[model samples]
Target chain A: MTTDVLIIGSGGAGLSAALSAKEQGADVIVACKSLPNNAQTCMAQGGINASFDINEIDTHISDTLRSSHGLGSEQMTRTMCENSAIAIEWLASIGVPFSLDEKDNLAKRFMGGASQKRTYYAQDYTGLKILHTLYDNCLKNGVIFKNERLLLNLIVQDKTVQGATFLDITTGEIEAIYAKSVVIATGGYSTVYHGFTTNGIGSTGDGIASIIRAGGVASDLEFVQFHPTALKKSSILVSEAARGEGGYLVNSEGERFVNELAPRDEVARAITREINNGKGVFLDLRHLRREKLTELLPQEMKLCRLHEGIDMATELIPIKPAAHYTMGGIEVNDSLETRDIKGCFAVGECSNAHVHGANRLGGNSLLEIIALGRMAGINASKFEPKTTAKNQEQLLKDKHFISGVYNFTNQINFYEKREFLGKILYHNAGVIRNEIGLKGVLAAVRQMQKEFTFMGISDKSKDNNTNLVEFIEFGNTLEVVEMLLVGALHRTESRGAHYREDFNSENETFRSHSMFWKEDGVLCASFEEAK
Target chain B: MIKIKRFDRKKEPNSVTMEYPITEGLNLLALFYKLKSTLDPSLSFTGVCRSGVCGSCSVMVNGKPTLACSYTPKSGDLIEPLDYHPVKRDLIVDKTKALHTLNQAQTWIHKTNNIPRDTQNLHRIERQSNCILCSSCFASCPVMAVNSDFLGPFALTRALRYTTDSLELQPLDTLTAIQQNGVWDCTLCGECTAVCPQGIDPKMDIMNMRSKSVQNGFDDPTLANMSFGFDFTQGF
Candidate 1:
């Protein structure tokens, strides 16, 4: 299939881009692994950051920069923050039923690290509403949706990325699709935690992996943001809305060590410290009014009761930090275009704008995604269709790589090895990192990579085989995880989400973003200043 | 022991049941993960957010529609794909036909007037907006047996959401569209309300839309044709 613009994922970023591109008279197609509106955007429960009448844009930018520990690009932050109100208006115009105040204005809330109540919300299920509205509008505008198609490879030749190859999950057919321009909005890699993450199963950094393998650069791959308040039992996210709605965190000693409204990195680190000290960390909503809690945070209430068997009115919910969002992905420039690959733009959690440099502020992700989506859409829609053919060698290589995962039979089990990968990465490269632990993660991942060559996939059936699909995601996770570890090891400084125990102080020499890319078929990492 | 009923069209048996040690958890998605990884590596299912929010992992447990990532499962609990839809593979039903009702019903807001200034009350539509589209309601609705063209619960609720919206101008167009196989076709068995994970009462939404349909010039087709009487088959 060919179109003017092909969006690889149908989350907030992809859908918004599709809509904007369609509005620009470009024929657009959105291809996703699963159904649309089922992506990671709905997991964001707190709200979207936008200042209408409450706060200044500069204040929002400062708060974001402070959260990123001064690594954020002020220009990009300015672009996002300046256009945030317009983003909110665009979402509202598309019929996102944002909760309104008594005076008939869009209601807002305070998420962690926000200076004011700037996060516009639709109760607690803010992201869900926005995502659904975007989807509703996209469908209304006749955005063609190709569901259940997994992106396999980007069609990159002559230094211009045109389209991609997709494996239809149902038919088991590998088809190459071409577009004038392709937008890789496939969200994040937080699912590397596998079972212990707040992300959807499909958040495997597929877009970033495909982009990097297509010779795109990955920026700040080290900074994985572990949310502070996932339920200890199931890792289902207990949103920051819980804390924003006056819930507080307490240790086993019944003491609040850190402010609940501090940035997520601080809260997560404090919780990890308490856990390391053998004190159980818990989120207490016992003091909040029952009616208020029920009205504002219905999802949190249900999650706590069903997942943890705790009623927020009576008992404290046990909490653990889980890998929630990846603050790093395929590095995109100010135009949201990849520096290395022309015509291949990235957006949302899958693209590192260097706006949320080291750590992301809570509500800013939703804001930045909309801005980036619009930017990419306007830029991609104006692109003239230039034909480019993939070299036979590259096509054959992808075919071989895809076919081998199904045909290879060995004693090594990918399932067990993946479980092991999650464990080591979480314990070592988790919230807290040190030289020894980072190196340990490196060594273990290397062994896992060696074993991956001989890994056995038990499922032989080709029809609707999630066994093969998940195996592909596992391979992508392995590739992205290596970049994360290498970037973490090379930084050698404590800043934002990348906390180094041995090098516990932030250093001026390593202020730039940790950029990773391939050099002659080998993975490489270095601190590179933004152009 | 836990047994998963797998369905593949290419396979001989049409459906096959495989057993593994019963693993208990807060939800069955984790149990399925343990089952798939350890016992039978070929077991197919889609589990995204185990938190019940994503609505991807809906299945039938013990012949009841349930979100596999949200509902707790026990030993000997029989799991299957959604009841009425064709199962693409094990526990993963093809939702294309079911999800198409949204588009068919034109559930989007169609504003006929340019009302620039606005006063809004989110409480009016907040409940309807919470739908996660797990298709559990569509799966459980007995009305689906008689009317495959029935707009289903989620689509009707969405129509009601727009009808009640202060910004929408063409509520009548929406209500009229949902009159046949849309709102009046529902049997109001409350199965949709029972299975909804988001606590969205599509049954109630359908009931409310029925009143609005009458409030406008639209009538329940069964009643419009008949002289007078309540039609249990064609909802109140």
Candidate 2:
């Protein structure tokens, strides 16, 4: 397939980009690995942040920077905050039903890391509303959607990106697509934690993996944000809006341990520490009236009742921290274009423009995806088409190489290795990290990589083989996990989500972003001073 | 043991019930995951989020369309793909036709480029806009069983949303768009309202839209004579 722009992953970012590109008269084709609305953006429960009052833009920037802990780019934060009001307006124009107050104003609420009540919501399903609106707008604007197509490799040669190769999951066909520009909005790698995540099943950092396979560089791979309150044992999110709306967090003794409205990093760490101390954390909303709970946080109540069999209006909800967001991904400039690869741009959670710094705020992610996604789309639409013929040969060769390796017979249990890796990642690279634990994880991952080489698929049939797709995703997870550990190991100092036990305090000397790249198939990392 | 109705395309090309050991607290999606991972690697189903938000994992469990992510498996539960759409694989139905109805109904708020002035009265429409397009409502709608072209629940609920939106530029256009296989075709059976995971009452919204259409002097001829019959009885 050929088009003016090929957007991978049809979440909020990809769909927004597709809408922008199509509105700009570009033939946009969105290729998704799963259903269109299945991205993590749809799972966002809290409202999106925007300084609608205009005078609060500086406060928004300061809050974001304070939450990021000095790693977020001021330019990008300002851009995001400045564009937020317009982004909300654009969303409303496209039919996103943002909640309105009793006075008929855009309903705003308090969220962690915000100094003002500027988060606009449509009840509790803000992300779902925004995603559906964008998807509907994309459909109406004639943006072509090719679902069930997994991006396997990015065709890049001589520092230029052409298009990509995708595995059509339905027919199991390896098809190469050519495009003038490609946007990778495949979301983050929070699902690398697997059973302990709030992300969708497809959040395996596939875009970052494909970019790395194309010899691209990614930064800030070490910082992974763990949300404070995922439902115990299931990792389904109980939105921050619960706390933002006057819900409290209590220990097993029913004492409020931490300020519920504190920054996510602080609150998540508190929850982790409480769990570590053997005192279970619980989200208490039993004080709220039934009518208020239903009117305000209906989805949270429904989820709790349906999944955990607990009514929020009457019972205390068991909760814990879980891997929620990836603060690092494919490095991009202000234009949202990859630093190394021309014609390839990354946005949303998949691309680290350093807006979140080390830790992400509750409501800022939706803002970042829409604002940066729109910028990337507008810029990509105007870019001149480049020669993609040379890159096609290399991508095809890489495709065959992956198929040949996976098509082999072996005794290595891929599922066992994946489970082991997830445990290592959650335990060592999880909420708190230390030198010894990080090193241990790195060694374990290196051993698993050797076993993974002999991994084979049982179902070799070329028709909707989910096993093969999962196996491929496991490989990507391994790549991402290795980078995460390496980046965490090299950082050596605590900042934002990268908490180190030995270096428990943030050091000015380590106030720099960690950059990771591959050299001779071995992961290497370095630091660039904060800009 | 849990029994699953699986579509085996290779051998019989028909659905066959198979048995597997059940784990405690496993939703239907997780059961399918376990079955595909251990017993039959070919067992196909669509899931994403594994939460009820995305609506990609809707399936008929014990003859009722609901989200497999939220519906816990019971003993001998008969799992099947949602009705009113062609089954693509085991428990996976083609959602394209259902999704297309959304576009055909022009279910987006007509762009007014004007900021909403007063949104206090928008609570009803806002509640209707919560439709996740899950199609569980559509899958259970009796109106769709007989008339596939009926705009169904989500779409009409969507139309009701925009028609009630004071910010919408063309509210009348939205009401007119749903007049055909739209509100008039619905029997108001409330199946859609019952199956909605988001708690949107499409039946009530459709009735409200019907009243709005009548107020706009666009009543359906079939129902117009019924009102006349009541007027004739009052005269007697």
Candidate 3:
């Protein structure tokens, strides 16, 4: 089917972009692997950050820049700063209710990096409200949604983009969707870690793999944000809003760990240090007003109350640093257009515009989606679809070249290997790293890569093979890990989320963004100085 | 071992079966599918995203409202529909209203010029924006059981989300809508919060809204008119 724009995700970015593109007179189709709401965006617990009356745009902007460690673009930062208030207003027009302050204005609350209250939210299920609202609006506007179609590959023609091919899980049919422009908003790839702040099932980074395989370079693959507190066992995120509302981090010994109000990186590092030192970390809500705690996060508190038999309002909730947001992805320019791919763009977690840089602030990630999703959608509408007649020849050659990946007679248990890879990445390239561990990780990746060459899939069909698909994704993850190790090895500085214990000093040279990619299977790194 | 039986109110009358001797790894969803094949083919229920992100398969398991997709079934467990809503059939109940009511309450942020050309600012309440609309909050809400117009915790939570976004410009209208029949309706009983499988706190959004509303001179007249408004509802 021919579409004006094919959005390859149903999360906030894909849905928002599809809606905007449809409004711009485009035939938009939001292709989702699961139901519209089943994406990881719906599992988010914190509120969106936008400038409301309680704070100026500068406060939010400065907070974001500060969180990014001087790596965020000034123009992009300013643009987002100026547009946040109006975005909230537009959402309100769509029936997103804002909790009020004493003046009947939107209630603004303070979070991690922001200097003043700017975050607006519904009670806690803000993501749900936004998803449902957009989904309903999309239905009303006649936007087509192809749900449960697992995207397998993008059919690129020449230097221009064409469309995507996907496997319909219900019927196991390989359906082709041709589009003028494609948007990759498939979210982050946090499942590369053993236990993550992300819902593991949705961490495949499918959109990203498709883009990268189409000659799009994924940059800054090393920077991953680790949330300071996740439920110890389940790794379910305990929202930053918890600490924003006076929750504190404590040690197993019941001592306050770090500045309860520090940036996410600082708090996460502090807790990680404690865990490394044999003192398990816990998030203490004991001193906070139980009524207020229960009121702000009723479900989280209830989980502690019912499942753990500990009232989070009165007790300390055990926690640890969990692998969270990815700060890298398919490289895109200022307009969210993928470099070298004229008709392709990326948004949300899958795009590395470097807005979040080294680490992202708590409320800002949501803001980025609304801001970037709209921009990418609006900008991509101006693009003219290119005929990929010649590009088809190149695609055929590339396919022939990579056919060996599927033709190997050997096989490794990808699921088991994935688990091992996750454990190694978490232990070596996790919150704290050193040259020795990174090198160790590269060695491990090589060993896994060697083993993966023998990995065989049970299904040989081109139409549908989940095991094969997973194997391919696992390969992408392994390929990406080499860059992470290289980035970590080159930084040699302790700053933001990338802390190298061996070179523990906060060096100015390492303040820049570590841009990494692969050429001829060799990992390379370049430092882009922070603006 | 004790065996428990559950019937589908929609498929067939008295289509009950022994659900125990259930495999150790059996969940509520597995039990339902078993009944579908063994008891009646016409048996229908709701489920999507069996991994628990979708809250469509919520049922009363062991006398507690739980998501059938995630909850493991037990011997002698009593499985039924949520307490407040009328059962549509067997375990499925009317979920269409909860999400619609949330939409009616303007549970999302309305923007104007702040429509971000980039996604950076849209992330302010981005995580909270990930609600699956499972209606577990409605099933768990104490106020919604007696007063249908309470707006409940989920709707109120969604309403408050806009107030929390950094991009929202018109806080007044959103807050006003939230304060009216939305924030003021929640009893702060914590039932909705407790039952939320996603760990979202709709009750807290209500409390935040109440505080914000009081700050805005929108007092809960229901609380104020306790001597008068209490006359309408006899159960309270």
Q: Would you list the rank order by TM-score, best first?
A: 1, 2, 3
Encode model 1's per-residue lDDT on A23-62: one tens digit a residue: 8999999999999978888877778998654358879988
DockQ score for model 1: 0.57
Fraction of native contacts in model 2? 0.55
**Model 2, range B1-236, lDDT digits (tens) per residue?**
76667664555647788777877866678777777766666677888888887888898877788888898787777778898978766776778889888788887666664767466656667677666677898899988778988888888888887777776778877787888888888887898888898888989998898899999989675565465335664575
Which residue pairs clash in candidate 1?
A: none
Which order, best to worst by lDDT? Answer: 1, 2, 3
lDDT winner between candidates 2 and 3: 2
User: Any runs in candidate 2 off by more than 4 Å, and if so which?
Assistant: A52-54, A241-261, A277-279, A284-298, A311-316, A388-391, A398-406, B113-117, B172-177, B213-236
DockQ of 3: 0.10
* Per-model TM-score (chain A alone): 0.95, 0.94, 0.90
Output the lDDT of residue A445, model 3.
86
True contacts kept of each: 0.67, 0.55, 0.16
How does each model score on TM-score? 0.94, 0.93, 0.72
Clash pairs, model 2 backbone: none
Displacement of the residue A58 alpha carbon in candidate 2, Å? 1.7
- CA shift at B208, candidate 2, in angstroms? 3.4
